[model samples]
Target: MNAEIIGVGSELLLGQIANTNAQYLSKQLAEIGINVYYHTVVGDNATRLKETIHTAQKRADLIIFTGGLGPTKDDLTKETISAVLDKPLVTDEEALQSIESYFKKVNRVMTPNNKKQALVMSGSTILHNNYGMAPGMAIKVSGIEYLLFPGPPKELYPMFENYAKDYLLSKLEIKERIESRVLRFFGIGESQLETEIEDLLEKQSNPTIAPLAGDGEVTLRLTAKHADSKQAKKLIDDVETEILQKVGPYFYGYNQTSLPEELMKHLINEEKTIASAESLTGGLFSERLTSISGAGAVLKGSIVCYHNDVKQHTLGVLNETLNNHGAISVQCAKEMAEQIRIKCCSDIGISFTGVAGPKVQEGKEVGTVFVGIAIEGKETVVHHLQLSGSRQAIRQRSVYYGCHYLLKQLKERD
Candidate 1:
């Protein structure tokens, strides 16, 4: 079924808040093979919301409304929808009791305005709110479904997941589940990846391929719909295999997973402890690594040897090497990686040295990065990358490349 999402908030239009609920809902809808054709953002104005609903009703069968389900004056979502459908605004006694109980339990004075949250349209299925005051409702008037959910993400996400999702699913005749996978790539340009898979996109139908470019990475989302989930996954895998036949070398991880997460998993599984020596990334590589739970088993530590003096005195890089090639050189990266491994006594050492910039530095242009990896019983290997992005983007991408490189090495050894 085709769906349209309406995000009702003056705060959203004013840029005070983001419409993340639409994003979350769209993903949920897509899993059940529902197409979210349009996302409309309306302010707290009742007339505008009514117009939005009128417009959506002409095109979409499912209209999901988020926000404006609060005690405040601006919360006019349900009122407007009720007026448009000519449904009476009836008070949900259960929701009103819950709100009253909350105030009584907390020993706080209950303002009369709190009753606003308990308003629901008559002849609607009450989607109970477990998170907050506003209990959402799903109304099917004239065979067109309208779901009104709370504004706060904490309240909206859970309410939708618990009640609204099931309500929508029961209405839908979904013969298949839509499974999607994202193949993340760095080092390769989006244009290049697209050019390579141009034919696939041009003739795409089942398991469609979509390419998206961002700061310093490219992601290809592969989606397939099938009655059997395993068959759907196999279709996605087949599409991935076809794409990987040409551009597999640049592929890193899958949906919602990054190079750092994948690298940590590999490192943990291999029983290898690692450390990082940073110049440009400022220990960002280690920072990401340690952010993962149980990383203490695989990550030793890191050193931010940003200054030449720190590189010399702490990590013990030769003064001559620093004076000769500067800190951005591959030799300095190699030394930094080796020194950190020696110091941390880890099985592997990684280093990031680069000119991430808004301007040039040390006779090198911005985005010039050198990733050095020193593994036990192997010569220190350096991978130089001439990246592109702002200083922060370049630094973060350097960390990603570091993980990619480390993962590649581990895979090769295995």
Candidate 2:
């Protein structure tokens, strides 16, 4: 069934807090084979909330409301919904008793307004809150289902898991499972990736392909629906295989995995140690690697040689090469990579050197980057790139490219 999530709070509109409830509910609904079509956020005003409910009723079979269930007068989620649905609010005896017990245990006097927390829509199934006082409720009006949940995550999460989930499952006539997988790619643009798999996207049926680009990386989320979970996964896998055939070289890891995480996994599996020499990127490459746990097992050290003098003295870059070709050249990158490997006694060494700034360096344009990869007993390779973006973007992309190249080399050995 199609669903719409409505968040009720002025804090969300004012940016005082994020609407994380919508995100969490969307994922949960998707897992149960419900498609979330839209997310609506409205303030505490009852008139606006009533208008939002009207809009949601037109397009969505299921409408879920979060927040505004509290003791204050502003807590009007149930009142607004009851008015919209022409339903009366009645007190849930169990919920009222639970709230009274909580206040007594805490040695606090219960106010008259606190009883409002026990109110539920007439003929609605009450969802007991184990973590907090306000209870949740679900009811159907004119063939559309309406669910009310508390705003706080601590209360909402358990109520949904323990009560709401099973309630929805019992109401479902057809049980279909939705499965999704995310494929991550670097060193490739979204337009190019889409072009390569244009036919698959056009003819998609069981498994739908959606591409998203962010931070110099592209990801495709493939989703499939089936009665059997394994069959749904198989449908996604078949589509993924077809897409990967065209862009396998640039494809890295899967959902929520970063380049550093994948690289660390490879290094740990291969029992290899690595070091880095940073020029334009500072210590970004090493910093990313060290952010992951067990980084000490695979990372030896790093040398930051932002200055020509440091390159010459610390990384042992030849003075003649720096004078003739400059620090941004291929010769300097190769020397930096090789020197760091020797100094750190690591199995692999990577170097990043470039001109990433508002102005050019050594007559080279901004975003002129060179990444060097030196593996033990292998020839050091340097990749020259002319990128475009802000100085920070250039530095970040340079580090990403360094990891990509290193991963490629490691895979080749395998």
Candidate whose lDDT is highest: 2
What tens digits encode model 2's per-residue C-alpha lDDT throughout 113-215? 9999999999999999999999999999899999999999988998999999999988889889999999999988999999999999999988999999989
Clashing pairs in 1: none
Q: Runs in model 1 with CA error above 4 Å?
A: none
Put down candidate 1 lDDT per residue, 225-317, tens digits, no spaces: 888889999999888998999899888888788888989899888899999999999878878988889898998988899899999999999
Off by over 4 Å in 2: 104-112
Each model's RMSD to truth, in Å?
Answer: 1.9, 1.8
Quote model 2's TM-score.
0.94
What are the clash counts of all predictions, listed in order? 0, 0
Clash pairs for candidate 2: none
Instruction: Give all candidates' CA lDDT scores.
Output: 0.91, 0.94
